[model samples]
Target chain A: MKRELTCIGCPMGCRLTAEFNGTEVTEVTGNGCAVGARYAREELTNPKRMVTALVRVVGMERPLSVKTEAPIEKRLVFDCLAALGAVAVAPPVRIGDVILENVLGTGVNVVATEDIGG
Target chain B: MNMKTKRVDLLIIGGGPAGLAAACAAREAGVTNLLILEREDALGGILRQCIHNGFGLHTFQEELTGPEYAARYIARVQELGIPYECGAMVISLSPERRAVYVSRTEGIVAVEAGAVILAMGCRERPRGALGTPGWRCAGIFTAGTAQKLVNLEGRMPGKRVVILGSGDIGLIMARRMTFSGAKVLACVEIMPYSSGLKRNIVQCLDDYGIPLLFNHTVVDIHGRERLTGVTIAEVDGKKRPIPGTEQEIACDTLLLSVGLIPENELSAMAGVALSPATGGPVVDETLATNVPGIFSCGNVLHVHDLVDFVSAEAARAGEMAARFLSGEKTAGERIPLIAGNGVSALVPEVLSKRPEADVTFMFRPRAVYRNARIAVFRGGKQLAVKRARILAPGEMAEITVKQDAFCESEGELTVSVEEVGA
Candidate 1:
């Protein structure tokens, strides 16, 4: 199988073609750098994405924004949002405060992105 | 009726990243009295609702979310003891450097300042600006508004969405809406190329498997009361929709991210001349406007692609205001700047030849040029030239010319791009 896509590794945006055989990427071409080859291999198999979302704050008019400590499985984004939708935190929350420990067992903790005063 | 009045050495409008950075810089520059007025209830401006990361890379050398980036400046403003008022909207500004404002606490207040900095940022071009044939309905919203609704209010805009433009904000929101369980049918752009950054296109749309249809636009908006669907069509070179190319998609919301316009009504009220191309104030190298005591920066001066640039520009504007108030600002000959070719909406329309101040000419390219040379000319004579691998209209390009490269004699300076071997 052949997959064509733009490289997110850098601004150069080298259009890449990845030839894979049953989940094993064989060769990557049209890359300006080594980073593109690695990106194609990782994307063809296991893909991850940084998740940024909002969580409800208990008794507050606005929600608190949060992000995954690291990129999680791409397919787990909506699941993470669903997880965040049900959880609420108390006031005096500071940025970098952990909201969810190991969200959906992805091992990526959801951390707050903003500070909210009580 | 008499209103509460006060005087300050420098008064900054809008307490966003621009105003906050400017106030800190001005205070550090030894400006004794300075104040910032923000119409919003908070100090961060639109950054308050921008929860996604990828900001502050240039300014802090770190990737931070919008609020985190704004917090850095807000903290500096506090430590420096710069005064600011929230919900204080400057209603009018006069050429005399007097400003009238209204706030919930200070019903009416007037301020006179030695100098002023206009930091009011830009606003999104609305549906009315697009001239799209659509009924005034409830389901339509500007992309930023939808972003605010999702990020700040934590409320979804709709279950199914159709975004009209490929601006960065719209691209970001497309991913945001998808995370919230909304099905974004398509991202339609009237132009053949996307104005958003390459990184965003890869992560925001491609990662989610969303289709980005270039050279297409919404021809007809369906469902009168609430948005039920929209008919999109491909456009010709002139951007006119071709007949028989219309395809209808069912969606509950239409998000318009067509473009952004600088909020310069107050600048115009103060009699500041605006550049027709940028829809912002015309200023010199120091970001000082035609009016001696007034300066402009950030989006009010010109729409910037990044907030880090806005903060950097605003910091300089603050320093310029400090120089203006110090009674030490030297009078310099004004050299006019022209966008010669392959460039549009070049900023700092004029150059102020301060002995130590080198200026960078920033502009948008008319089209894509690879392996191009940006040339700076003074009276038909080339003064400086810079090389770039690629330049595109989607990205802002710049060339820095040293102060000594220019002659003492005043000459019309022009900035243009030339494709190598063209």
Candidate 2:
């Protein structure tokens, strides 16, 4: 399968075109550099992404926004958000405070980015 | 038709970090008569809306919020009693560096300057500009506007949100909305990876558990009265949405933080040559635009990721503009700046013809790299080289090429970045 992939891994926005002979990769072009090629291959085979969103909070003005401690399985973003919906944090939250421990049993802790004053 | 024309030793446009710093620097450099014109009523530009603390970590060695960081310099501008006009919008610039400004009550006013600094910062890109298929609705707000509404105006625009684009503003807003009692449904990015800093990705989104939908886009906006929901689809390798993968996510607001374009209409009207790479005026090391008397710096020269760098660059432009007014002469044989492979754009579009000075160039990489080498060449002869252990598009790269490379020689200078060993 011949495919074109855009390298959005960073600000460069590299345009990449790739050729795959069956399940094996063949050639890549239009990439400004090699990292784009690597991104394209990984993106085609096993795409990964960092997830961010919000969970409910008690005694606070609004919900507490949170993100996975690290990159989770890219395919599980929806499942992760579903899990985050039921989670909630209390007020007087400090930046870098852990809101959830062992999120989805992935050993990743959902943390807070900003301090919430009570 | 004779407008009120005032004369000043130096005139700086836009009252952002760059403009304020430029005015102060020029004043300290023995230029007494200086004027700064700002369109907004306030002095701080985009920084005013950024309520989150994280700024001044590098420059001040302490973390400060955007307004706090701005106040530090604004205080200096006040202490120096710098002359400035708020609510003054510069409509045009002459080739000779005269600024035409208009205010509601003041009407049309023109200011002739011995030197002018163009500090007009950049503007955000909206969803309509991306050619993305979506209904034009009331819920769409640029990340900055949304930031202004929530952080400054103290108004909650929506209770449920869907953000498009993962730039710093959008990413930061994802966290902000969650704190503002809104449910951020998801952040959709058409690209496979994020365009924001690693720290932001980790700190802003990861901490909040906000769903950042990567390689996805909002194909349709569902509400007509207000925002009801959004249709998001997974984009393939080519960034086109893959069919049968559409997922409807319920949301009331759609925030766009796609990108920024330098606000350079005045430069354009003045006939200053612009670089296609950065969409800003082509400037020499002195930050002088193609038009000798008109100078530009900060985000107006090129979009900068950090405000500290913007201030530093603007100070240089301010200092050089004062020198120009004091009879600093430019020699012939100015070298035009050219971008090389793996390099998106280079600033200070021209290099000085003299040998004793050092000229700095800020650039963005074309892709992510583990080990890279940035090299500067004149007429195909390598002039300067620097090594980078890691490089990413989110970060800006600065390199200074020695003035000697262009002193004795004349021609185009090319700045290229390449992966090590490749």
Candidate 3:
């Protein structure tokens, strides 16, 4: 099977072609750089994306912004958001404070990216 | 009934990425008494709400979210002990660099600064700007407002959304709303090509199987109290709605991400000359407005597509502001930097004759061009040329002219794009 993808590695946005055989070994072409090639391979195998969401904060009118330390599996993105939808933390929250630990057993922690104080 | 007065070597407006970076750079360049006024309750203006990743790639050489990118600079500012006041709204600024502001803690404070840097960024073009035939609906929100509501307030604006304009913010929101379990019906753009980056078009819309309708616009809106749906129609080349091409997509919310306009009311109050093309301040090479001792950078100078570029440009503005404060000599005899064929707008509207250093000109093209050559001309003579594989209006392009090339050339520097093998 062949799939055409746009490499988001950089602003260049190179159009890439990926050749796969039953989700097996393949060749990737049309990438502008090595990073684009690696991105294409990883995308075909196990696509990952960094997840950002808001966690409810007490004593504050607005919620605190949080994100995963690393990119999680693409398939688990909505699930992770669903998990975060139920979570809330209290302020005096500092940046990098862990909000959800080992989210969905993915071993990725969602940490606060903003400081919200009471 | 005496008002308080404070003096600083430099006063920066807006404490977002541009202002923070400018403050740090100015301080490092030997300006000690620097004050930043931010209207927000905290630092990191818009970045505080932009939690999505894909920022700071050019500056940090790594992928970072908006807040993460902002935190890096916020930490630096704190470490440098740069004095900044949050919740301080600058009310007026004079041509003499005198500023009056009001805050909850400080009532009616004034500041006299040796140099002023206007970093007050851009704001989204609201629904009123488009004049869509619709009632004053409650569910219709600007994309940035929705972003703030979703990412900052932890509130979902609506369950079903129809986004107008495929700008980056709108494209990102389409995916964001989808991830939040909201059904995004369609993203409509009146322009044939998207005004967003290609990566956003792919990662945000294409990844989720969301439909992107080009050359289409929402002509009419339906809703009495809240948004019920929007009538989208295909537009001709002149952007006129084609009859019999109207389609109604039922959705409770409508998000507009049409465009961003530089917030330059403060700049105007300072008597800075404005650029009608850029909708910002007209600036020289050092990002200095025609108003002496006043400099502008970031989105306040021109709407920038990337925050990384905003930081880079504001850093230059900070350094220049420092030089102005310290009585350093600068280039003389300004020359106009003209945007010619296929170019829409150019920053630093004029170039200063810096004999020792090269000057970079940043501009956006009028449309998408493949295999194009960006040529710089002076006195009708070609000075330099840079080949580009592709150029798009969404992405800003830059080209540097060596000091030797510039020093030898005369007259206004005109930059234009030519199609290769055309």
Candidate 4:
């Protein structure tokens, strides 16, 4: 089986095609860089995506933005958002401060993407 | 009414990327008594609402979210002790660098500055600007507005969405709404190609399996109060909807990411001579506009594809503003540059024969071309030419022409696309 994939590692967005044989990517073509091949393999096998969202700050006018420390399973994006929805923070929150430790049991911690309060 | 005019070494407008970066550079360049006035209650400009990643790769050498990227500069601004006022709206500006602004804290404040940097940024083109026939529906939103609602306010506009443009914002929202459980029907682009970065079209749209319909546009919008559907149709070569080809899609929201126009109302008020091509003030190699002691940069000068470039360009403008404040004038002729056959908008409309630094000239190609070369010629004499794998209007083309090329070209340097081998 063959599948078309676009490399999201960078802005180049090199269009790539992967030839798979029994869950193994045999070959990847039309990639501008090596990241594309790795991306195709991961995409064909177990795809992951980084999720960014905003959580409420206690008594603050604006919400604080956060992102998963690392890419999680693509299917868990909504579940991660739902998990984040129930969480609120008391700022002076600093960047990289863990908002949800291991969100959705995915082993990916959601951290603040900004410094709020302090 | 009597008001005291405050004097400052430099007065920067709009505390966004451009203004923040400019203030940092100016302060570093030894220009004290500078101020940044931002219209929003909080600094960071639109980045506050843009809570996504993939920003700051060029400047920080790492991918960062919008707010994260803004935080780096905001930290620098604070560390430098640069005074800035959020919620201060600049009302008027003079070519002489006089500015008047108003805010709740300080109503109708006047400032006399040695130099001013126009970094007011840009605004999205509304549906009224598109002239699309629709009965002022409720669910319709500009992608940025929807982004603000979703990311900032934690409110979802609708579950079923139909986006009307393929701009980066619309493409991102297609994925964002989907991540929050919205069904993105399709992303319709009037042009044959998308104006957004190729990365966005891939990750934001393709990753989620959303369809992108090229050469199509919404012909009619449905619903009396809240949007229920939009009538989309394939467009002809002239971009007009082809009759009898209308197709309706049922969706609660219609997001328009049609285009963005540089916010130049203040620049016009300042009497800065603007370029009809870039919709920005006509700037020279130093990013100095035709008006003396004033400079333009970032999206307000011309819409940039990346915020990294905005920070870089704003730093340059800041440095130039600092130089202008020093009261040093160079003796040189201001040679003009022309956008030839295949070029659309060229920034730094003019340059000096021997610029102090190598100038990086940027422009938009009129159309899509592959295996092409861009040539810079001065009346039959070709000064510089660079080959490109592919060039499109959606992506801006840039060339770093050395000072020697400027020295070689006596009068005008016309840049245009040509056959690769030619």
Candidate 5:
């Protein structure tokens, strides 16, 4: 099987072609750097992304911004967001405070990235 | 009440990536009495609200989130023991580099600095700037404001969304809203070409299966209490809406990511000459404005597509400001830089003869070009030429010219681009 993808590793946005043979990579081409080839390989199998979302905060007009500690599987993004939607925390929250632990068993915890004052 | 006055060798007007990097560079250059003034309760500025990754690729050679990229500089500032004041808003500035600010901790203070760096950054062009026919609505928000609301405040501005511009922020937010389960109907751009990075177009729009409409704009907005929908129409070459091509998109929110304008109110107050092309201060090779002791960099000098470039340029500005405070004169004659054919504008509108080192000139092409040659000319004599595979208005291009390249030239420099075949 042959697939064409744009490498998001950098702003260059090199168009990459990946050939796969029975779940085994055959060849990758048209990448500007080595990172693009690695990105194409991962994208062809078990694609993952870093997730950013919001969590409810009491006594505040808005929710607090949170993100996964690391990139999670691409297919699990929506499920992770759904899991984060049900969470709420009070104000006086500091940056790097964990909101959800081991989200969706991805071993990635969602933590606050901004300080919300009471 | 008694007013307190402070003196510093260098005063940076912002504490974001640009200001923070400038302060660190100035401190490292042996400027001990350097101070940074930030209006927010803490440092980091806008980066605090930008949680998505894709920053620091050039500076750090790794992709870092906005906060993480900022923390690196903030940690450096702390490690250097550089002094910075939070919740300090600079109210007024004079041509003599005197600044008056009011802070919560200190009522009102005056700052006398030998040199100042203008790093106020830029602001998004608001709805009023677009002049779209619309009623006063609640769901209309600038793309940056929406990003802050979603990323910092944890609020969804709307459910069904229609983004009015294809800027990087708008493209990123389209994916952000989609990941959060909001329906992003479409993205509209007035220009035929997208103004965002290609990486964003692929990762944010293509990945989410969102349609990007070119040569289109929102003509009318429908909403009385909240946003109901928006009427979009295709435009002609003049950008005026065409008849009978109107389509109404039922969206609860309309996000505008039109463009960014340099926040130069302070630069103007300080009597710095502004560039008509960039809407920022007109500076020379040393990043020094026409005003002797004042320098400008980062978004306040021009809107940069990458934060990495902002840090690099601001570092040069910091070092120059330090040298100015140390009473060292840059040895060279001033030569004007002209942006000719196919080039939109050039930063450091003037270059110095026999620069201490190779100086890089940054510019943007007026339009898209493939396989073009960017040439620098001095009185019809080509000094340097660089071949570019592709050039777009969204991306900034740069070329470095060695000091020896202009060793014998005493004439003005003209930078232009020409098609390889034509």
Candidate 6:
């Protein structure tokens, strides 16, 4: 099987292609640098990305921005979003505070990305 | 060989918003001996290609085009009489913060400085990264490069086009193509939501009658010598193209507006440690990288979504770089930077150990939110919190860590967010 992916490891976003036989990748091509190849191999097998978004905040005109406490498995991004929907936050907020304690059994918490005024 | 190298108080690289701001700030900080180096004959980085308005909303409190926004800084730099080298490409950078350059007139020279600022900016993602099956043809170009060709070079790309990725550049190009007598067939995006701001979707596409295909991606390209057409597919929950759903769109060109990546070859060669999250060097509040005398700012640190924010961030780095050179800041101790929930990345990748000043960290959210709470923590203790309104993937959020918070802390500093009210 042949597959192509953008390297999420860095913003270089190296558009990479991998030739895979079953689960093993045979060849990788089309990156500006070497790290692109490494990213293709690693991500093609096990992809992961930092999940960021927002959760509801108290006493504000809009939602409080949020993201994963840590980079979860790439396959779990949507699932994480679903879990995030069930969570809520309070106002008098601070930057770097976690909104959800443990999200979606991933052990990764969802935290705030911005600050809310009291 | 007697190599007579000039030691300056400050040396700045890449002559963009960050370099200009750094030069100005360094001068203000009392470092009169300064020099800025630019690779291009012009000073602006990506701003030169951006012809449409909508910049400077935050920093300048007015909407301006890329060139117009850049002109403000360029004029300021000029008014300050800051010395700069144009058409000078930096060949290498030393870990000790020395800048090496080469030009047509000047064969080679090294500028040793008390402090150095890296502001090379970013590059666009290309077709190779997207894995779209197609012939490598002439009609394919990154949106920014195409913009430069048309807006700056006085040339047209093609008559009809298909654009991949709903980034700001792609959206802007959609409008630009229409204005330049070309018809944009459609704008396709793999993600369900656009990566560009809400206003761009309305002004660039909606106002122009360009169709936007969400959850769609270009699966194949058809062309021999030039672009002729492309096959687009609808993506499922996993964002994989659905078989049999491919539709071929006839066109002469493909414009990729996927994303931007920080240009860090010089930083990498200089041995500056970079954050995997941002793909840029980690620095402290002073914008100084781990290598004490070396500093960084602007798109070179991270791919900023807005040019206005880039200038503001770069100004901070410049001020810090000037302080470093003037003996106002001495290396004390440094700490690690931590990212919490709903945060994709952080700047000033590292923290200072004996931090005497505050540090501002920038990051992106996970998805759209109605009400969210952003908070900072250290050693399992909450440090500060702020409320947010309507956060999206297209926008970047900034948070500041007070100097008082770092005064007695010794562990990892974390930034996170939570949803408050629905």
Point to the candidate with the largest DockQ. 1
For model 2, state the Cα shift of residue A112 in Å.
21
> Which tens-of-lDDT digit does each residue in A42-111 have in candidate 6?
6667655555544555554455545565677866766776676566677866645778877777788776
Q: Calculate candidate 1's fnat.
A: 0.62
TM-score of each: 0.96, 0.78, 0.95, 0.95, 0.91, 0.76
Expressed as tens digits, the lDDT of each residue in B1-422 for candidate 4 is: 68758999999998999999999999999998999999998889888878889899899999899999898999999999999999999999998889999999988999999999999999999988988887998999999999998888778999899998999899989988987778999999999888888778877888778999999999998898899899999999999899999999999999999988899999998899888999989888899887788899999989888899999999999999999999878425678789997888898888866788788789988987777898888767887788886788878888777777666656668888965642
DockQ score for model 4: 0.54
Q: Model 1 segments beyond 4 Å from truth? A: A9-12, A21-26, A33-35, B353-355, B408-410
lDDT of each residue in A49-104, candidate 2, tens digit only: 45555566675445554566577766676677778777777788865688878777
Docking class of 6: incorrect
Candidate 5 chain B minimal-lDDT segment of 10 residues: B328-337
> What is the lDDT of every predicted structure here?
0.89, 0.80, 0.88, 0.88, 0.88, 0.77
Best by TM-score: 1
Point out the higher-scoring one by lDDT: 1 or 3. Answer: 1
Give the local distance difference test score of model 4. Answer: 0.88
Q: For residues B24-107, what per-residue lDDT tens digits would candidate 5 score against the true structure?
A: 999999999989999988798778877788889999998777887888899999999999999999998999999999999998
**What TM-score describes the B chain of model 5?**
0.97
Q: What is the interface RMSD of each candidate, in Å?
A: 1.7, 8.0, 2.2, 3.0, 2.9, 18.6
Worst 10 residues of 4 chain B by lDDT: B403-412
Segments of candidate 5 deviating more than 4 angstroms? A1-42, A56-65, A87-102, A107-118, B330-333
Positional deviation of residue A19's Cα in model 5 after best superposition, in angstroms: 6.9
Fnat of candidate 6 is 0.00
Please give the ranking of all candidate structures by DockQ, highest first, separated by commas.
1, 3, 4, 5, 2, 6
